[model samples]
Target: MGRIAVIGAGMGSLATAARLAVQGHRVAVFERAETYGGAVGAFRRDGFAFDTGPALLHLPAVYRDLFVKTGKRPLEECVELVQVDPASRHLFPDGTDLALPNASRAGVISALDAAFGAGVGERWGDFLGRARVVWERTRRPLLEDTLREDTAPLGRDPYPALKRGLLRRAPATVAAVGERELRHPGLTALLSECVLSYGLDPRQAPPSAAVLPYMEQTFGSWYVRGGLRALADAVYERCEERGVEFRFGAEVTGVVEEDGRATGVELADGTRQEADVVVRGAPGEPLPGDLGRFVVLLALRGARPADAAHRTVVHGTDAPHDGSPDGPAPTVRVLRPDDDRLVPDAGHEAAVLSVTVPPQGAVDWRAPGYADAFADRVVAVAGAAIPGLAERLLWREVRTPADTERETGAPGGAVPAPALAGADGAWLRTANRGVPRGLYLVGGSAHPGGGLAHAGMSGAMVADLVAGGPGGSR
Candidate 1:
């Protein structure tokens, strides 16, 4: 069996290592961080815990499949998985609040009808129906299978919108589709904000991106009993059980390529470890694309109301955040999990408020009081989601893009765009198989692309390529 050198201890990287080890290969994971999880990290203060990265899980079947394949215990046996019922609550500029039901299309339509009016729900439902078409079309080739070198076939969208004349001229982007189909401004915001949550600009995102909302709405959003970070820990533990080694605080400086084939990795300390397969799990190539989030973890003084929504998005009003009076208002996502594990006690609540901001190149996240000032503005917007938020606040901690860069090693804290159909393949991530034979890319920056489920799919594809399993490499 070949020795595998995985670059980071992230979810995808760990998933790859565990699966490869189960296939009878030797795997060792090296991570620069002190812990296993790369971005799936947690923060604690005064006994209150908050997820520093993704707080919710969508499409947990990816991990469930991983557990079933790698060991006897299923995912639920490893980590207590619970479905968040309300999925999300949306707040609009017109003071309309809609609590969307998880995996319940009829219920969602009803909620939208009750809030937005009679036909608005029907319009959104129709849009979702189209989005489902997008999902079914691309789910297999773009996600389940590995990307081939030709890549031309993948660029041709399976959206079936243009030739079919779904619209006047086949809307160029998500926003365009939303504008044409969801004529209501509020509906446009809902569709746009859903894309924005993925760090994509609805104005530029391909219509194929609709698969994101489709996947979530169909599969439903979930949470672990502890936190999303627990999922990563479970994968790491599974790796250990399979005899996959982990080296913390070990950073890879470069891949040792010989004659167009990866042979080993060089550590930051000038040490070289030979391996037959080298996987790039961490982000090294800095692509200056997509906006990221500004997170504020609030430890509040009151218990979460029984009826309070789990996730609430305050749609960006026509406002700005760069101290300029003009740009569109940044979308804010507030997550207040009902799990008692997150709060200090039954008397208090722990919540996270995240705002999508322009990338570091576009916005100064480190200007004097930039993060703090921006955090204050985010809190103000979040108040729309959490009533009487100002009074409930006990203390708040802010996380900036700089913090992201420091933690995840993504240059300028730039987030990666999820794999989409159009953009002339510009949005296509690097293939799971790297240019050099034996070197592979497996993570958010790689094929399939970001979000927990996509990352898992990327790992599965990479493992398949390594094991000569289904969808073997070219």
Candidate 2:
């Protein structure tokens, strides 16, 4: 058995470590932070808890398969997964409110029709049908397997464009698809927000970006019994169960190279840990113009309403739909999970409001009053969903891109979007291989790219390549 050194204790690296340990390899994980879960973190104060990262999980099978392969205990046994019914409620600028049921196409269609008048549902449904085609065409190449050496075919757009008139002009970007197909302002805004939520500019994102909504609507949204942090805890525990060693507060300064191949990692303390292979879980340089999340955690005085939807999206009137950065406000997503663990007591509630904005370099998140001013706008908008929000809010905590940078070591705290197959692979992430022999990239910045599920897939691909010996499948 060979020795493997993992650079970070993020989900992707933890998943890779567990799988490699089960495969009889000696694995050790080094994390710069004192705790695990790079971006998937939790905040606690005065008996209240909140997830600082992703609010929901989609395509849970990716992690389920990991747990099954690494141990006898499956993922469901590790943590309680609850499906979020009425998956999300959307409040459009035109005063249109709609609640979409979880994983039910018919229900979503009916909801759309009821909110936007007749025929709107069919149009949106038809668009998703086309999106499924994109999903089927790229799922294996993009998610299930390692990225190929020649990614030309995967670079081409797979969303079949409709034939308008005698000429068939394929929509290049997601915005074009919305303009030509959905046609309605509300529907277009909905599609734009879906892509924007992933930190991608919908105006420039490829049509294949549609796969995001397709995946969410198909697999449904889920929440862990505690928070997404619990899912991270479960994965970390599984790693420990597999005998994987972990060194917290151990920062990797560089990848040790010998004879043109990575041999191990050099630590911040000027020591080196040698191994047969090195896996880098830290994300690559943030993409130019990429976005980061601005979040506000609310401590409310009242109990969560029984009828409250787990998630709500309040679309902004000044959203940067055209890729301009000067918009007064961007779309905001409000999360109000019913889990009691998030609140201090039965009489109180916890809610998180998040919005996508330019990363740190583009905007100085540390500037006085910048974050709170933005938070005020967000709270005002979220008030549309949460009745008497101002009166209910007991206190608020704001987190910005600067905070994310300090926590994750990502420059500008720019979040990476999942790789898409279009615009000549402009959206594709770096390959898991080709970094250097004996070196592999596993995390949001590589292969299938970002998101909870895609990161897990990256781990699986790396493990597969390591097991296949030198010059493994690419």
Instruction: Give each prediction's root-mean-square deviation over alpha carbons.
Output: 2.3, 2.2
Task: Score each candidate by Cα lDDT.
Answer: 0.82, 0.87
Which 10-residue span in candidate 2 carries the lowest summed lDDT? 317-326
Candidate 1, which segments miss by more than 4 Å at Cα? 162-167, 286-288, 318-328, 470-474
lDDT of 1 at 332: 85
lDDT of 2 by residue, 1-474 (tens): 999999999888998999899999999999999999889999998888999998899989999999989899999999999999989999987788899999998999999989998999999999999999999999888988888889999889999877565677888788889889998988898888888889888878888999999999999999998999999999999999999999999999999888988899999999999999999998678666468988999999989999999999988852432213455555779999999989879999999998887788788889888777778878887899899999999899999889999999878888888989988878888888755698999888888888899888899899988898432212
**Top candidate when judged by TM-score against the true structure:** 2
Q: In model 1, how large is the Cα lDDT of residue 400?
A: 75
Error of 1 at 9 (Å): 1.1
User: Relative to the unseen true structure, what is the C-alpha lDDT of residue 362 in candidate 2, on a scale of 0 to 100?
Assistant: 85
Query: Residues 1-474, candidate 1, lDDT per residue (tens digit)?
Result: 999999998888988998899999999899998998777899999999999888888878888889999999999889998888899988887778778999998998898889878988898888888888888777777778887778776676555453235445676777777777778887788777778788787777788878788888888999898888888889988999999998999999999999989999999999999999998899755444566777899999988998888899888752223533345566789998889988878999998988766656577787878788767778888888777989999999998767888888977776776788776776788888886899988888888788788788888899998877664322
In model 1, what is the error at residue 456, expressed in angstroms?
0.7
